[model samples]
Target chain A: MRIHVQNPAGTSAFSFTRAQWDAAVKRHPDMRDLEVTIDNSDDGWSAALPVADIVLTWVDIVGAKLRGCDLSHAAPRLKLLSCNSAGVDRLAPFDWLPRDIALLNNSGIHADKAGEFGLMALLMLHNNMPAHIRSQHAQRWAPMHATTLKGRTLVIVGLGAIGGGVARLAKMLGMTIVGVRNGSAPHEYCDEVVSVSDIHKTLVRAEDLVLACPLTKDTRNLLSRERIALLPRGARVINIGRGQLWDQDAVCDALDSGHLQYAFTDVAWSEPVEEGHRLWATPGLILTPHIAADDRDRYNDITLDILFENIRAHAAGRPLPNQIDPVRGY
Target chain B: MRIHVQNPAGTSAFSFTRAQWDAAVKRHPDMRDLEVTIDNSDDGWSAALPVADIVLTWVDIVGAKLRGCDLSHAAPRLKLLSCNSAGVDRLAPFDWLPRDIALLNNSGIHADKAGEFGLMALLMLHNNMPAHIRSQHAQRWAPMHATTLKGRTLVIVGLGAIGGGVARLAKMLGMTIVGVRNGSAPHEYCDEVVSVSDIHKTLVRAEDLVLACPLTKDTRNLLSRERIALLPRGARVINIGRGQLWDQDAVCDALDSGHLQYAFTDVAWSEPVEEGHRLWATPGLILTPHIAADDRDRYNDITLDILFENIRAHAAGRPLPNQIDPVRGY
Candidate 1:
């Protein structure tokens, strides 16, 4: 068996030394019988197609290009494609893949980091910290009365790994957690769980709404203008997931009108948003370049461990963990 | 049991509606409860002072005008003198006529309001919310990374009512609470408690330090230039107490040098701080006009209740609930 690994530049995993790689291989004795090819090139499509039994690819790679490549002429043995990401929207319309090939994702790996970002955003809005910082800089003692989250309601739009982590953290801070997911079943961390179809009705009860869902056909632009308006005045919104899940223009309008107290987004529709974007000027808006899941050391180690475990399971003819359901498009 | 309440406005308690005046009388059932004299005129002071069993006078009357007023002449009848404030610095130097006059304060009344303010200030510094709000107003997607308090250390100065409240709330949010007070007594909410003598040494461990001590001779300029330098870099300071507790120049310099991330202050050496003060333009400083304890409806009610409770205790010869020892000044 042989494995191929590909990742973006500056990722520390690319610098894993020979001794460390040897130790990792020793820990996974099954990999001793396998051949591994570490490919760090833009032309990974042509380079990795040959001799690779398993492929580990970065999230940014264009899935269509990988599928169109003539893999049978190169790496005919490829049986699995593992994504170093939680979402698989970019890999959509994936029906063209060989039927025997399996897809797995790095889903739970980013939970802690993303949940940390979401909690920070909520605290920022509730305390009106930004206004205080500006006043501090100006040496002005302009104190304002800030709201407390002690008895507030938090509505999590998804109950996946990241959202579950957020719910647990928020609950510890004395907040009431209300979760909305596609499934009808209630989550353990949420005080109330409603189907995604009742999201608008649930909005009225949420004091702070957090979006932590993947971008699927059913979830794209899920927070439409009408739904955004349904949120009570002074409600806050935090998005640590895909930016396309919300109607950005409507969010900006709500923030501008002071109807929504604040909104924070780590993921944007466009990377490196243009200078004149309306979101830049919206009142009570916090924007961060998509870095919600950024624990470099830990994330790299976790990604590698997940990949190694999946490979071992595959060789034993056992079920692969984190296997993506093609129908669900998770 | 005739009590005399002296306010600068010189309006008698009788000037209020019958219901309001009766409420005050009901709290002190032991009092003969004669009509409350206005005492606005200097002449009324001489007559009212002699016969009064209890005195609730304004701080202004106890200041420089002490030379002209003959307080000792009326001291024989006075059993209690309750100050309607947390600070008694002005009353400290005065030599009361007798040791029996109990000095009480409205301490616990302001804890919730002030603690809420400190929490808000800490959140502001950690989240960098104001910068985001400004960028949002400018319509620019200025992306920046923010710190979180989830795993940070919070150092609280003065583990009394206000500081204790802050510790309780921060502890609930998963923060490690370290406290400094006059004594080294163990505190229930604090993970570690240190004496004021060890504050400089403890500063190194604090990521967020809150000033909640009263302004006193010993604590004046406690956070001096030399001591401010001892704090961990990027540590934030939230002062909900007296401004004199911190060295303004040193704090400004730390913020300007980017060593101190932010400062939030509700109290200043001067009220309605004049324009052109250095603090007004200091980066990372939040200036609030000392309204931390200003929950309009709750404020008056809480303070009045404290006074009423003390008056009742005084009339029955019971120990006052919030008595302040003049020597310690808290």
Candidate 2:
């Protein structure tokens, strides 16, 4: 079976080089036995698409209008499409995806990086690092005090790979975790589990709130202004999920008013935030420019590892762990 | 037993109020059985010190020329001096402390807070949060990449209560810990233990270096300019120990030259840093204004708990857990 790797242009961190592919192949030598093709430019896709049995591409290249790149038209032999992102939120309502092809996401690949970032964000928020950062920049000697994370309540929305990773680290640090997800299934890291409908009542208990669920019809604006008011004063919010998952203006307002002590958002309402945006200088807020989970050096390797594992499972007629459930739109 | 509690003015976080004393007494009701007298002024110390068998005061109260406050002459009845600080480096040589008096330093009280702060500083350094803070302050959307800390090497100097706390958390995060202390005794959290003499050679292996040793004649300027040069390029430095332990100028220069990726120093060469100090605006450096380990709310409770435990041990003719060894100066 032939696998075509699409190198999309203009994606800096996600753009994997040929050397990275070689390095990944060194880790998974069994891939050397299979037929693999790569393309760097727009024209290369026209040649690579028709005969490829599998496509390992970034999520950005999925709905692109490149010549002969349409999966339903030119890619007649395509059986699998592996995306390099944990959240396939953008490709939701997978109407563009052909019925015959199975989709796989790089889910667990980001867990390690996300988990570390999540832990860092939680600690930073708890310890009032954002205010200290502001004081440092202002050439002030103001000192803020903080309590320990132990015995504090953490209400995490979404018990998927990213939230679960955060929960595990928080649990190890001796925090009481209350997990909110689409379902009420208990998670090992969470002391208590509640469904999305119960989130309104759960917010009052959240000393630290983490948004890690996928953005979908049910999740968009999950933490609205009304919901933001439900959280206890001096609470912290960390968003490793999509930007649309929260009401950005409400977050900024809460931070400005000191209702929310601190908030760390790796994402923003819009990429490349506009000048004079409130988020740029919101008090007690830290903007990470959406670099939380993506590991620069190991992204390609982990993505390929997931792809290879999926390939092995596919050959053995077993289920793919990273396979997406289209009906759920994640 | 007569116990004098000296509450010094102007010590914001460390100053325990009467309400705090009552709260602590609620935690340890047995303390109420003893004759505990609190003095909040210079005159009060003079009155309480003369008749006191035990003195509980801030480290700042030591060596003060207050009338009837001299442990050597005015307070002849004193047998135990319980200080609120973990490090009694200032009261070294025991010249002022009566030879008959056994001193206790609040060591384990700060362990939990110090451990949490150390972990936060470590994560911040590894993830390059200093750079991100700069970017945010400048209203720039620059994105920097970072690797996970799971496999990194952390070399910590002064593996006492504070250092051991950092080690425990770092070990939980899966980093290899190399501890440098006065002795080579194996630490449960440390993968390897070495004496302070081997620190120069061990600095090369450190991706993260922590200064948690006590300030002493032997530990002064431990991480000097030459030793700082020995660290691997891009290594992060965390100074939770005394400011005198490291050559602050050398750290600033390393950060300026990009030889060091990041450094977090809660302690500074001179705190409430003078205007135009390089530490105020050192690139890739985060100056936290010396508030790393002190919990504002729980500080008194923990300190009182340690005092009560020490009192129990002292009454039982057992070795005091917090007693300071003057020969070591910590």
Question: For each candidate, how many residue pairs have backbone atoms clashing (under 3 Å)?
Answer: 29, 0
Worst lDDT window (10 residues) for model 2 chain B?
B63-72
All candidates' TM-scores?
A: 0.77, 0.96
Note the Cα lDDT for every prediction shown. Answer: 0.73, 0.86
* Model 2 misplacement above 4 A: A10-14, A17-32, A65-70, B18-32, B65-72
Clashing pairs in 2: none
Candidate 1 regions off by >4 Å? A1-5, A10-57, A62-67, A70-80, A96-101, A129-143, A291-298, A301-321, B1-103, B106-153, B172-175, B233-238, B261-275, B284-321
**Top lDDT prediction, candidate number:** 2
Indicate which candidate wins on TM-score. Answer: 2
Can you give the DockQ of every candidate in the order shown?
A: 0.27, 0.75
The digit string of per-residue lDDT tens for model 1 on B1-330 reads 666666655453212233444665576564335556545556666677787776665556655444345556655676666666666765665455246667667777666656665665676676664455445545566555453466789999998778887887677667899899988998888999999998878999889999888877898898889988999988888888888898888899998998998887777777778778876666677676776654433544455567778877766788788787767776
Q: Give the 10-residue window scoring lowest on summed lDDT in candidate 2 chain A.
A: A63-72
